[model samples]
Target: MYLYLQQQIQDVVKEFAKRQFDVDANVVVNQPPRAEMGDMALPLAMELARTLRRAPRQIAEEVAAELKKLEIVERVEIAGAGYVNLYFKRAAYATAFDQRTSGASTGKATGEKIIVEHTNINPNKAAHIGHLRNAALGDTFVRLLRSRGRNVEVQNYIDNTGVQVADVVAGFLNLEKKSAEEVRRLTEDPAVRFDYYCWDLYAKVSRFLAEQADGKAMRSTMLREIEAGGTEAARMAEIVSTAIVRAHLKTMHRLGVEYDLLPRESEILHLRFWDQAFALLKAKGAVYLETAGKNSGCWVMQYKGSETEDETAANEEDTKVIVRSNSTVTYVGKDMAYQLWKFGLLGKDFYYQPFHTYPDGHVVWMSSSERGKPSPAFGNGKIVYNVIDTRQSYLQDIVAAGLRALGYAAQADRSIHFSYEMVALSPRCCEEMGIELSPEEQKRPYIEVSGRKGLGVKADDLIDRLTEEALREVAARHPDKSQETKELIARQIAIGALRYFLLKYTCNAVIAFDFREALSFEGETGPYVQYAVVRARNIFRKLAEEGEGAKPVAISEATLAKFLAPPDGDAFWSLLYLISQRDAAAEQAVVTTEPAAVAKYAFQLAQAFNNFYHRFHILTEQNPERKAFLLWLVRKLEEQLTATLGILGIEAPKAM
Candidate 1:
């Protein structure tokens, strides 16, 4: 409702500028510092003062007079040198709120498709906490886009032919002495989580390669065979990577994250995506073969910021190799091709096959070398957001530079790298999890998790732990509730705790994962907001038992205007204003690509609702009309808070 009023004011002010002053301008709307000042403020008069050679106060008075004609604007006052403060007509605002149901249509449909690629974990082992942060951030952003009426496709890239997967295959073959068939049987066992097995095996391979020089040769041989295909090593790679990919999907599903497609590096190899990308690069002079220096015989592109006094020195010092001396295409080269396909700039397409069917009836497809069945067309996004860690910022830049070098500068410009910092464990969290910390590590603020060292929490393990703790709380509070009911509530709270914890931090900030901080019932946690929802429901439940019906019916605008008039109702009015700004908060979150904005808004709304609850006794009010009005306000608050939680991918349970 606030967004609607803001747009109305902007249109009116923009037209007023063009007609009265003969000047074209952009009108920006902002909130006043205090609610008593005004609901919305426009400082356009000060902006036009110098251009029109007039005093700001005089221009503000003139604009304010014209703006008073708007139906939604109750009055416009000029204040403090040039500010135009606009107040909403109380009855009109109430009518607008009463007319629309919760979760009404948001922004207009944008025809362009947006592809967001995140959770691109290597298909080698179990996903860890770091991967959970990536998925939570990406999934929440997808929800925000859809809420704003965008056509979005979620893609999770798989690096099946990368060194990580090759290392696992080497461990199976050389270290464990397992044949291809034996590995396949192990993957087929329903009781065995193959990814968890590889999690430890991957770490062992890393240690072996570091301690023994001969182990390096085995890894290289396994990588070549996996990429070359038609070998036993390639079959083992397929079995392990395919099983691990399924495990990853299941892990993410527990958190309500889903994807439309999985584009694999193996498919990129079999489908010759790099061959076409390489041809384009060579023809456009985006990359060239180095004949001399340390990079001899390798195809390389000049680094983006490598300019120096001497051209030779610059190229020698900062060239990024696209193709190694052994003729293997680098990860960046393959990523360039993948990015090009996202925007429909690449002249090639991937054959796709259905990879898995989710419980919700959504079919997730995977890229294939040969067409298996009719599938929906993938890629061709007008804009793409790659949610990668900050460590890969340089490689991401190179991918975008490749697009610009090939003359698709417009697509390159639209390519966004939604980079974020890594997630680390808080020192307290390490102690609580029973992981011994070194004396030096204990003094640091946070400890980083490394999958290669087998020193990280598995995503599933953390979820299970949270669920168990939540169940204990629920059982204690609702002792008589059925076992199934308690379990369901526990799962909802656990998921809400995890998703909110991962999303509440800004993208550029490093989060130190701590269970106690996330699951706490008070102060900026998911359970706190969720408890607000449950409390509001209890009010309605009590009213229903007193014969007021199961839900509060809408009160007339005339009654609202009388009750919300002044002094005594000031707190109530303020709470209503906050509830009406949900759309504005969602728009801000979308524009910034930060879920933390919405999460913070949810916490604020929850805080406001709790304060209102304590100040008023709705059910005990003797005046029937005032009671109805308070009930109506509570219903609106509940609706808006629930919608906000939905956008953050958090569920509000019936009880805390």
Candidate 2:
């Protein structure tokens, strides 16, 4: 309703401009500083002042006169140097909001498929806290798009044949002297967590590679065998990476994150995806052979760094090697092929097989080298969003540039890089976790975590810690509840705290994770918002037993309009206004590709509802008409806040 009214007013201004001034008016709508001022304020008159050489205040008066005629507009006033303020009709606005069939954007579908590829963890070790941030942001963005009625497919790309996986494979063979059968036995042991064991071994191997003489050669041989895919080293790589990928899925599932596809790097090699992409690049002259430079005998593509836009300034430093002299394709080369397949422009497709099935009956498919049972068609996306860390922005740019060089400029424009900063442990949090820090680290605001050094928190470990902390709180608050119920609620609260903590910051801002700040039930934390939902539900439960009956009071729109007028109505109207803007917030979040917008909206809605809960005593009020109005407010606020939380991928428990 808020978006519709804003558009209606903009249309009115455009029509008025074309008729009266014989010109077009590009209007921007904003909210006033205070609710008492107006709901929406537009500076159209000031914009027209410069174009028409007329006084802004004079133009404002004319526009106000015409805007007052709109049914949705209660009145229009000109304030402070020609600002056009619009006051919505209270009854009409309430009726429109109640009539809304869907909380998402005007109940319309874009008719285009959007693919979001995220959680591309290298299948070698356990997922760390840094990877958690990527998954949370990506999953929340998928929810936001789905809430806006978009057709979305979630993909978790698995680099099962990458250097990271090979490093761990070398650790198993050269360091442990373990055969493929022995590693498989270790993976199947009930007491052993294969991923956790590999995490420590990976760190040990990393240190050895720096200290020992033959470590680099060992890793190179292991990598070559894994890429070739027919040797014992390849079989061990398959076992280790597949087990680690399963561990990653379980970790993500605990946070309610699931994917529709798991595209693997091995399939890209076995099925010749790179071969098709290389042919296209060669046909278009997108790459050439380098002869006499540092990158001699390599196939290179021109890279125009952002430092300079002049194409004539190309030099040896401006070249990126796509294929080396040994006929091995680089990571960027395979990524270009994957990006093309996403848009269905590669003229090649992957054979998919079922990878895993969730309890809810959603089956995740993985790329295969051979045909399998029937499955739904994948790819052919109108837009593709790759959720990666900020450090990979240059590689993402090269991928988009590759598309553009091949004359797929439209697809290149639709390829979005959803990048974010790293996650670190707060100084206080490190102390809580019993991680001894150096004196220099203690003086800093945050401590950086490194997976290669085994200094990072595992995703599952963090979730378990949060759940334990929440369980203590839950036992204290609701001691009489059953153990199962308390445990379930504790898990929900833990996930809510963890996800909200990761999402509350903007993508570009670094997050320093702290336990106390996230679990607190005050301020802008997730528990605080969750408690508001509990409070609202408690009101309705009591009303069913004490008020008129279990059924809601059938109040007229006229009565709602009365409470929205004069001295007392502004408070109720303000709350209602914000509630109606939930869909608009979702649309805005999608446009900016920022999940923080929706997270912030959910927090604000919670705050407003809590204020309303304190200001009005609904059950004890004697006047039936006013009591019915207050009850209606409580219902609307709870519904909207709960819906907003769902979009953030946070669930409100039955009780806090």
Candidate 3:
């Protein structure tokens, strides 16, 4: 209802401004500082004064007079010479809020497809804490879009044939001297955790490459075999990558993250996506074959440092190798093709196959070279958001530039690089993980983890650690509950703690993971917000046991209006105002591409409810009308907080 009313006011103001000023004004609405002032404030008068050459005060009075005729507006006032403050009808607002709480849609549906590709972890190792941040951000953003009734497709790109996977394959064959059949047997062994085994092997191979003289040649050989396909080395790569992908999926599923598709680089290669993209790029003069300098024999593209560039510009450092002198396509080259495919510009598509299915029957499809069953149309996104970290900003820019070079200016404009800072481990978290830091590293605020060194905590391991920590608390609080029930609640709390901690920070801010800080029940943490909802449920449960009207009574708009009136109703109105802002908060988060906004809102809403819980003794209130209103307020708080938490990918547990 808050969002609905906001749109109504904006539309009304925009139409009025165009009619009176003959200008299409961009309506900017804001909230007044104090509740006594107004619900919303508009500075349209001041904005138009310069153009109309009229006094701001006169324009303000005119706009307020016109706004006063609207049915939704209780009163309009001019303040500070130009600001128009709008006070809404309390009864009407309460009525509309009730309808909205009953599951009425308040958003305009955008039927265009939105593709969000995230958590593109290399398939050679177990997912780490950094990958968790990517998945949580991407998943929460998808939820926010879905909350607004937008069409969203979640994709997780798999780099199965990349250098990383090749290094792991090199470890299996060169380091372990294992054949494809032996590696296949190892993957099938029940005693061996294939992903974890690969984790150690991947690090071992990385160190070998850095230390050994012939390591690079061996790795190059493995890469060529993997890329060429149809070899035993390629077969082992498939087995290892596929197994690790499953493990990655399982780890992410623990946090309620899932994907619609898993697009692989191998499929991108075998399906001739790069072949067609190369042809298009060559035809459009987007790339050129270099025949001189150090870049000789490579297909290079001009890179003008992310700024507008003259087409005829030339420089040595400003060139990026798309295809190497050795005739291997670079990662950015494959990504450019994938970007074209996403926008439906590449005249090619991958064969489809069901990759995995969740417990809820959600099928995650994967791209394949072999034809499989019919599946939903995957790409051709109207807009694309690549949720890569900030380190890949340059490559992401090249992708958008590739699109623009092919005359896809519109697609380039819509290609959003949802970049974020990396996650690091705090000193305390490092200690908890049994990771020893050097004296110099200990002095730092956070320790960065390197996958090649195997110094980072695995995603599953971190989740297990959090679950165990939460389980101790759950056991201490509810020892009488069955073990199954306690574990369920513990997992819920763990997921809540993990997700909220990841999301509470802004995208560009680096997060130093801490265990105790995230799982605490009292601060700005997930457990704090989850406990708020649990408190509300306990209130209703107590009311039920006491034989009072546990269910909320349908209060009339007149009664609600009285409760929302000033002087005596300020507190109730304040809580109602906070509850009404949930939709607005979700919309703001979506617009800004910031999940932290929603996370912050959940914490604020929880804090507000906790204050109201202490201020009003709902169970012991004497008056029936006031008690009923208080109960209704509690219900609204729970509804709003739960919805907000849902968007953050945090579940409100049944118990603290």
The digit string of per-residue lDDT tens for model 1 on 1-656 reads 88877888888888999999999988989988998888789889889999999999999988899888888777888878789998877766876876765435766565799999999999999999999999999999998888777899999999999899999998898799999899999999988888899999999989988888677677667788899899998998998899999999999999999999999998888889889889999999999999999989999997676657778766576778999887888899999989988998778899989999999999999999997778888999988999999999999989989999899999998899998999998999989888899999999999998889887889999999989989999999999999999999999998988888898999999988877776665688888899999999999888778887965576788988887776676787888888988888899987888889999999999999999999899889999899888888899899989989999888899887
Q: How many residue pairs clash in each candidate?
A: 0, 0, 0
Look at candidate 2 and tell me the lDDT of residue 356. 95
Candidate 1: 10-residue stretch with minimal lDDT: 101-110
Q: Can you give the lDDT of residue 493 in candidate 1? A: 91
Tens digits of lDDT, candidate 2, 396-463: 99999999999999999999999999999899988987889999999998998887888788998889
**Candidate 1: where are CA atoms >4 Å away?**
22-26, 50-53, 102-110, 214-216, 434-439
Once superposed on the true structure, which residue ranges of model 2 sit more than 4 Å away at CA?
Answer: 101-110, 305-314, 431-440, 547-554
Q: Candidate 2 lDDT (Cα, whole model)? A: 0.88
Better of 2 and 3 by lDDT: 3
lDDT of each: 0.89, 0.88, 0.89
Give the TM-score (vs. native) of candidate 1: 0.95
TM-scores, all models, native as reference: 0.95, 0.96, 0.95
What does the lDDT read for residue 478 in candidate 2?
Answer: 98
- The per-residue C-alpha lDDT of model 2 at residue 248 equals 96
